[model samples]
Target: MSQKTDGDIKVPSKVVVAGFISTFIEWYDFLVYGTVAALVFSQLFFPKLDAFAGTLAALSTFTVGFIARPLGGIVFGHFGDKIGRKKTLIVTLLMMAVATTGIGLLPTYDQIGIWAPIMLVVFRFFQGVSVGGEWGGVALLLMEKAAPSKRGFIGSWAQIGGYLGPLVGAGVLAVVTTFTTPQEFLAWGWRIPFLISILLFILGLWVRLVMGESHVFEKSKKAPVPIASLFRYDTKNVLGIMAVHGAQSLTLYIVIVFFAGFLKTGASFTAAQSTLSVVAYLIGATAASMFGGWLSDYTGRFKVVGAGLVLSILIAFPLFAAAATGNIYLVMLVTFTAGVACGLIYGPEPAYFGELFPTQYRYTGVSVGVQFGTLAAGSTAPIVGTFLLQWAGGGTWAVAAYLIGWQIIGLLGLMALGETRGKALEERPGA
Candidate 1:
């Protein structure tokens, strides 16, 4: 292959496909758990608790994966920055496949007594670790390979996995639940989604194995200790990334994780209807991610992300109100719009974050920073929303207020970072 400078290098189509497929598999493994937790985990693993407490417990296990992410980020980021992005990404994919498929094979409370939930949390933690490492590698792999002007658009393909994973997860669950009786669904149907991870893992592994390492990483000065250098040199940028990403993660779990349960109980919707609503949100997110990434290529990352945060904040109260109305059409419509807002924030994010740090420690900086933000926001969103609903006497106003508050923080985060729309990957920020 002919070599070009980093500023103008054209990424191979296979590289993009590898990044997209690997990312999709990583997220699908992680997120399929959330969908199952919402629908069946409480009943299967935490059977002793009452409905509310059981749901809370199940969601808590979901958070376990997030808690493990930073550690995953720290460990994998170090190696990815030091060795290469390609190898670490392959490890993460295999880790997620094992954890997810393990969950599928696990016996529930009825079959194994107390060991069920204990083993469940163990598997979920591994899933968390896998995902924690997965995003940064793929994001950098795409961002560092693309020409400067096309970075945003190419990077968004990684973000598409974020939305599409959950979309396909919920869609698969919807299909399974539709075909199976309620009793059968609660018994075995949920496991199908988790088991399917094995197939996805094979596809992801093949593509990623064939793809080459990032040329930027190949040429950049390697950090002696990437994480330490990241803290010493780019702490502020890390915090800014956290803030910029917080609101989108918060809103995502609320819709994808919390809303399914809320609709089932609070709005009196069937499980199928609730699952379908998540599919709607994903559809909008998948489309808007492409648009936002393309727009950021022209308008700059701050403009595109800031507009998204503002729109999401404005829609917060309306979204909850529509959910309360018990009208599926209105709920789906508002949810789709909310997805659009969040997508815009997400689409430009990989390139923006990748641009913030020097290539020497870019992997560590992006992985740790984004994982911390996600752990703080996305990890707690469903559990926090559950408590807010109970505290508000089942009213959704408090939840809306909660969402708006985070969006404002995200706007502030956008203000804190410099625009990096067309910045060259090889150029250090200060030097």
Candidate 2:
């Protein structure tokens, strides 16, 4: 699949697989923290607080990682634009591996007291920083490396990988917890998922090593200041990227990650039930994204995203109503439905984001735009959902209302943007 030109710059079809691996590792490390935070971090690290307070505190830590994403995008994105995608990607992987591993080694509250939570926050912040750099780099590498005609399908590999991470993390917890008691899981069993990230680290490094640098980046001129060009030449594109990406960013965390907390607190679901539902939902999300991305090649990207936003709007109340039913099967069904909606929204994003900027500033533009959206939408979503839940005394409408707002913002952003599906990467428009 690598398309090599006259000389030696051949882009392998394997770039799609490489893209999947990159996001798989990145999101796997990221989501496990949220999964555990919802299920057990409250007990392990913040046992002093009562159930509601402890859950809130734990969910807050999950948001901390998201807060650091934009900064990661800023720093790593600068270097990625100045230098190249491969080196910047290598650094992000290292940061994620180190932080994820260190998290496994941290002593719990009983052993380390306040230092446990402080250290967890510090490591989680770095994890955010690492992933902040990760998405744009991977998306750029894949979309730029791919042929224009196939960018949507190829780029969706990132979305597939994104789902794979949480899928794997949730699966691990579901299995591990099956064997251990609640007492044992809180004490030691939770560390297995974090520790297992070392294998992902090794596997990711190998895949990255086999991949070549992007031919698009290699051929493009280096901007004197890439981000400056992004702001000056492509301001609207940046905003459009944020809005187009906003809803899915928030909904993934809120509807998927936050739902686990909701199940545990309000619905009395078991940890296994919550995590297993994630496993099934992720499988559906992966398939839906691949189909969505492929379909976007035929329909315009905006149409696919617009349809998805509409679906989210229609199902907003019903999805939560299912959750409130306290029937685990019904909750899982609605989660899968939302996963389908997310896949459609997420499928076209990597290609869509890349199309928004010229090669000179693509890394910075995409990174800044996507990371800011994550900060605004992704990181804060769970917090907002939990707060709404608390305020409404466990009402689901407020959460549904929050999702509608994201969809509307994203739709507005899309309306102002032009479609760029088959456009050549070098054909930087308007800017």
Candidate 3:
């Protein structure tokens, strides 16, 4: 169902828009929670605890969402394989919307006793599950429809949503907090951002409704087997994909999502300043991500990913040190650099990882790869970074050293693998 636009490139606008909008909604729900966890959730949800302990509690609740990602992947992957990608994704979208909007309505410590944080944990875990289910289908839907040469560029659209998700969340939160008195903001104004997710989800749903099922997945439906066969037969490929995904997750959640909080709490920036800087960083990252995907088409995924890892190692300490010095310009420069590095890794990942498994096993393979990272590196980095900051007397060195170490791990993982550039989807059996 390709439509001819002015460029006359045969393209499915509805599918592309659906894929983009759906991912935007999913990540919007996920990122807002992360932004709040880093800044306000610790104060709101864990109000009774001391600052450090409260931060830890908030992070732990956030990680609970990560902990559920694998299960979501498994469940959604199973149905995506058996029933279809479109319907399975629709269900995840609904779940995410409900859980996210519910988080806005929950009572605090004064009204609900222990149920406040308890309900937050439950809603967050559901959000995690929904996101885990969401990414695999969104990637599959887009990559399946795109031309081989253009798949990298197309797939990177999802990464754009990832960056934009935080921007929207931080931007809205920043605007709301700016106008409100601190007392009013801390009381109920913060809930406005979470409540607004209902509108985002509804808009995304409207877009997704107009789209059709992916031709690739539809073609594969002729003789589909259970998704379980993927793990049972291709365990080695699964493990390899997991490693790469771990690298993406750790770099993303640890550095990008939590960096604002780190700057605000540890580096002594005001919340407004931190949010604005993060929005700027994300904007740069979004632009770099699209460019990185285009570069991968020419340069290859392995090289681009490997280069990003090396850059991470080299600049980790320098970037943090610059930010620690309280130079506003220096902070923006380093943060923007970090965002670009994340873009380099994230941009190429959808196609790279999708190519690691066969069409029949693609959903399970990508989901497992991603969620494994979420469970291991992605969820733990923020908490670990916080502890490292404390241990290092709030110095930037420890946080930088920790991030660099993980990047080195990802570099080694990428270097050990063979390049998969220029291989046709059908020619590459695993893919």
| Model 3 weakest lDDT span, ten residues long | 1-10
Could you say which candidate leads in TM-score?
Answer: 1
lDDT of 3 at 209: 74
TM-score winner, 1 or 2: 1
- Put down candidate 2 lDDT per residue, 1-431, tens digits, no spaces: 12333112335756666688878877777777766887898888899999999998997888788789999998889889889999899889889889989999999899989999999999999998988998899988988876676778878988898888877776787789899998898888989999988987887877777788987788878888788878888889888878878887877777777887677777788976776666656776788888888888788788888887787777788777876677888878877877888889898888888877788888999999989987778777876898997898878888889889898998898887778777666634443
TM-score of each: 0.91, 0.90, 0.88
| Stretch of 10 with least lDDT, candidate 2 | 1-10
Per-prediction tally of clashes = 0, 7, 2
lDDT of each: 0.85, 0.82, 0.74
User: Order of candidates by lDDT, top first?
Assistant: 1, 2, 3
Candidate 1 residue-wise lDDT, 273-377, digit = tens: 887788788888889998998899899998999988998888888887887788898988988888899899999988999988888889988999889989889
Between which residue pairs do clashes occur in model 1? none
Candidate 1 matches the true fold with a TM-score of 0.91
Local lDDT at 243 for model 1: 85
Clashes of 3: 2
State which candidate has the highest lDDT.
Answer: 1
